[model samples]
Target: MAALMTQFHVSPSGDDSAPGTEEHPFATLPRAQRAARESVGAVLVHLRAGTHVLTEPWELTAEDSGRDGARVIYQAYGYGTDAAEQVVISGGTEITGWREHEGRWVAEVGALDTRQLSVDGQRAERAGIDGLPDGTTRTETGYRTTSLAPQQWQAPASVEFVYRGIYPWTEARCGVAAVTHTGEHTEITMAQPAFDQAKALYNYEFEYQRLTGPALPTRVENDPSFLTTPGTFALTRSHPDHHVLHYLPRSGEHPSHTRVVAPALETLLRVTAARDISFRGLIFADATWLRPNRSQGFLHYHGSGYYEGGDIYTEVLIEGRQWLTVPTETATIPACLTLEHTAGITFEGCRFTRLGGTALGATAGVGLTVRGCDFDTLAASAITLTGDRDAVLEDNLIQHIGLDYAGSPGISLLGTAGCTVAHNQVTDVPHCGIVAGPGTGTVLSNNHTDRTMGVLADGGGLYIAGPQGDSFDNGALVRGNVIDNTRTPYNFGLYTDYGAAWVQVQDNVVGQADNSAVLHVGPPLDHVVFRGNYWNSDPVGSDAVPAGVTYENNTTLTDTDELEAASSAIRARAGLLRTQEPAIG
Candidate 1:
């Protein structure tokens, strides 16, 4: 004995004139969405095959559901062999002025700063030359004297330079601070000291050779005069320390205009929870916007400021403004697809295309999961996660990103934990594959990245910054990962910043790294382990690796440079092993 099931039918062709009862159905998705919001107990809705123009994106909230488990399901079908054309869900509704603020979704970008914002534990390292101690040099020639005998002279000790760079120096800089000679291997212990205002410590452990070979004369200084720009208080160096730096910039201010900047897809998906909401095989097509840039899109979970159901777009477009207008806030227009502070979101099969901007321009979310989705032709990053506690991005394809000349990264996540980014394919991007910021317990495993370069003036790959707290980052793992054609003119296979700890980089394969410097570790990068990692371009016995770092069972296949970078990488990394630890299976 079963209760009779109540049903509501909606056909755009059947009525602009009906009341939408079981006998009389109304037309349009807006009417259906409205009806579903007000109905109860497993409401099944049908759409007749045809094109439906959406002037505004639909919003689904948590309040639409009833105590008896109200449900709304949509599908297209033919009646009595009277088949219509395939249902075409086309035409994007213009969304404006929504941002993912804190752990909640908001329509106003101004509300983003009203919440608590802080860096997470676990440091992320970027390659910039900052925090190296500026040194002074005075030439001194030693001579053997016998009153009037021919005087024999010896080489000088050091040189002087200026300081104008970024912070939390790497190991090569630490070695420079010790002034170790070329071909002379010196090992130094690394440590992380606390910042005045923040909760993290910074530092890397590295090694370098002197200019004793056919290279040019040694230039001593915190910075070299030759590298300094004219009329600027800066100096540069040819050494490896000069190339790598750490970065943590402030998010730009929010715009104050009454008009909306860019709206997110989640904003329209927030139907009331009283209704059982389901987006089954729906298509959102040709989401062209007033702006042409890739950064603009929609925000989810508006007003109540918590989170809502995932708005799955089978196909969608996100563009930016034609002319660059100075934004009042750091968050500008075209920041696409922000899902902060919500759960139970699923994008089973969808395409996110044409995302641009500098940093967090595309794909900002928290507690979100994106599976079997695709990202294409993006200008900046495909995705950015901020303060997400638990998230999963699995078995997806992200490709053809970074159309803008200022290409950023594939994904950048900050202050996250319990996140799994696995089995994804990312290619033709301009920056690193996945950059995890401080205070994140993230696992980036079994992912494949190819042709990942940096922005015009930046470096590339798996840049890890330290957590805001001095305690080392826990559960940051990079395993079974494959990187191909990581062609950076300068930098490493990986970079670990100071105050970052408890990291494990294992069972990974890297190929055709154009740069010789592979793994750059900042001071205080202790308790970090690299095991069974293979670098095809890195020789097992070269100088490419910095000293004092630990490695085990790592094999390098190339060793043809002045530094023997391959051999150095092996020797330096081998030091980190406990010697008797069992090999990984």
Candidate 2:
């Protein structure tokens, strides 16, 4: 007869006029969400532990739901304490007066504007450069390069520029607005229409979209004479109410005992249209994104690079030549814990780290349930999920993350329904480790991908882009996964791209891939279907296996004791079979 639930606690040193119980807790988290919206039936709210910082976002709507069959948790008294009892919900802004200047260190931060910085908790490194110099053209409003002497830098409108070429699967960025040198050329001005609609969404040179790399920006970053690396960091505003940051210490760092951290709110949690909520073992950290630092500049184009209005304009024709291109549900990057149109939500064992964006974002949900979570580093994609329904991402543990978006991907999902990415453990990524766009009854089972495309090339370890339902019993199902490595070089261990339709690739296991056709299937695909998989070569053994596909009886392990007895049961049924602890009190 245990039908009584209504507990509230919250802390960071209690007192929002206490009495939210647990020996009078309730300090913030909106006064324990206004006493759990005036408690009625079921409700939990706990919280406790340390840092709750947040300078904004913490919203929840549908009047913070929990009607019929009540259930509105918000846990974190989790994992029997210890380890400093984690629970951080930070949006950053720690800084503290440092002062040093000559060899770097600075500080101040008041008029703040961030692009991420962490230091003592690691994750710093922004001064950047990495290429872009040889006759850099492209200019109607930006880019001319005669080689950075941009009028002796102080702040070329906060520099930025960084790109990943004309879609080796996109990663763009913008933000500089006026540099002017004109004579030996150096122009630079950008930050408008995000580098003019990211070169009109395809980096000029259309018609087969040529230009696959530098036409200008191969990378650049904030100013201060590009800081000449050493654990980097830059950022400046000078006056208009001050802002300065600096940093350069990386030899036992000691800016008055470093702990740093920057990131000033790019949404630190918002869940609208809520219903039976539930968020256990909390830890949504830092947070970044400021629309590529204003002027809507972050026009990335593919996969999770959802170009922010999802770029359009097509024209195709091919061999008959008529090309113009640009497609697919663009504009991704926006997930620092934002769940919209929620339903019976449930995010257990949560712990999204660092996060400069793309870390736990649910959209138009219904019966969502992300289990055993713990995505790391993150700068993009460690779970995006869009237009959900009956969703259920299982046993999670996506690692490293795209750091600062290189066409990021470790679970991107889109338009799902009856979704279910199981037994997860996507690793180190830079792109594709479970993508899926346009879904329906998807079920990528027993997951496990190692080393992911690392620095992106042509995405790998499970992709799928178009049509996902209307066959294999209502489509999509690439089972028992375990793809060991794809670290670069046009990867794939199951891709299916663009015209992909009604999927089904079974019993997966591709221990190592640099692609000689580790299964990509496209040239405009359709009905797809590969069966009984287990690679080591022979995904059509050297390409040429297209045509709405269908291959059967797969298995190409050229003996190493039959590939270690069939990859030891797919590395023992792939990752985290259990582990989601918390709640000891």
What are the per-model C-alpha RMSD values against the true structure?
20.8, 18.6
TM-scores vs. true structure, each candidate: 0.50, 0.38
Question: Candidate 2, residues 1-585: lDDT per residue as tens digits?
Answer: 877898888888888998878788987898898788888889888888888897898998988889668888988865435543678899998888888878888877778888888887778878877646777777677768777666677877777878774567777888887787777777777877676666666633345456522356677888878888788888876465587888788888886677888978988988988888888888888988877777777777776765665446764545544444575556567888888888888888888888898888888788888888889987888888887878889989889888787787889788887788888988888878888887888888888888888886877877878888877787888788887787787777667777778888887877667552433333466777778877777864335656567778877785446764876776677666774234369
In model 2, the clashing pairs are: 79-582, 178-189, 306-330, 306-331, 306-332, 307-331, 308-331, 310-330
Give model 1 RMSD, 1 decimal: 20.8
Candidate 1 residue-pair clash tally: 99
Cα lDDT of model 1 by residue, 92-136, tens digit = 322244444332223323211100011121111111222222232
Q: Best candidate, lDDT-wise?
A: 2
Off by over 4 Å in 1: 1-28, 41-52, 64-334, 354-367, 454-457, 468-474, 497-499, 516-518, 521-524, 539-549, 559-585
Residue 318 lDDT, candidate 2, scale 0-100: 58
